[model samples]
Target: MKQQDNRALGAWSRSSTAVLAAVAIALFGAAAWHLGTVALSVAPPNTLSRHYPRWIADHIHPELEQNWKLFAPDPPQGNGQIEARVRTVNGTGARHTAGWTDLSASDIAAVRSNLLPSRTDQDLLLYAWDYYALWHDQLPGHPREARLMAANLKRTALQRLMPQYQGQRITGLQFRFRFDRVPPPSWASPTTTDRPVNQVLPWWRVQNKDCQGL
Candidate 1:
């Protein structure tokens, strides 16, 4: 009876080891599947990605995907601004300029001091503007792309400033974006010879009927 009990104990130990091995393999496979999705999302398109296009669509489509080079090739050297001019029809029904509002400064000031600093919160608009500038007739081939970029910039800007126009009847609104290049470090001569270049975007007429369409 003692010999039979020992043999049964040995069999139980082997069974437990086999179960643990299977669990480990399953966990590893799960981890690898997620890692593959991430790898395919960011990596450049390849033959494998082409084959598994449906998988990427279901997993990491453009809306949910990310790109690395936001300020790439060469980073902007200077400061940037997105100033908004709001024209409102006052009580007399005459259109008057309500002065220029500096929307960019408000965004920069928000993220200057924070316990938990996030990149997407701080730079999404800033990058969106940059992206718009790059595509908007700068390269001179992508009219549709430029239009989409402009729409995105306008959408973000409007969302930020809509609260300020509570009581005012804003008839016209325009956004101007500026990007300045910084000078390289010269130990002997630190002054920049280059003047600031401004890319003034065309004025957009706002319509309450369809602000999203604007």
Candidate 2:
């Protein structure tokens, strides 16, 4: 009976060890499969394993996911400024035209002689005016794009100058831009010089839909 008991105990020990070994082997196999797939997913496009990587990237980091400009490119060689005027209507329908306000000058003042303020006034806000002018040149040919550009300008101006017109009820607004094209380098041909281009966009009635609150 003692020999029988010992034999049973030996059988149980062998089975337990076999089960643990199988679990370990399965875990290792799964880990290897995961690592191999991730490695293939991140491999360069030219490589043979790039099939999965390209597909994966299409799903995750698509081509249009980010705007990528050329490295260390020359800056834009032009200047643009936007000015807007407004007409305010009061009780009994009396109208008054507010003189043209230079929105670019205000933006410049915000970031001038200050270190902590962001470069937005110097580059982004100013560049936005340039974009607006470029869009204006396209005109009816690209109406959608032009409208979007106009919307952007209106939004920025509204945010910056809302306080100034808080009490008054503005009835309409007109916008215009002045762009000075930078002259070519001294060595370049005589065809291109500093040419001043003035663009006066059409007057747009201040609709309730055009602004957050007018």
Off by over 4 Å in 2: 1-70, 134-143, 188-191
- Per-residue lDDT for 89 in model 2? 73
Tens-place lDDT per residue, model 1, 135-186, is 7646445555667677777777777776776666666667776767677776
Residues 46-157, model 2: lDDT tens digits = 5546445444433332222223245556676677777888878777677888888988888778777677778665675565565566666643455555676677777666
Q: Which residue pairs clash within candidate 1?
A: 77-182, 78-180
Error in Å for residue 44 of model 2:
22
Model 1: residue 102 alpha-carbon error in angstroms:
1.2
Task: Report the number of backbone clashes for model 2.
Answer: 0
Against the unseen true structure, what C-alpha lDDT does each candidate score? 0.72, 0.68
lDDT of 2 at 195: 70
* Candidate 1 regions with alpha-carbon error over 4 angstroms: 1-75, 90-94, 187-193, 209-214
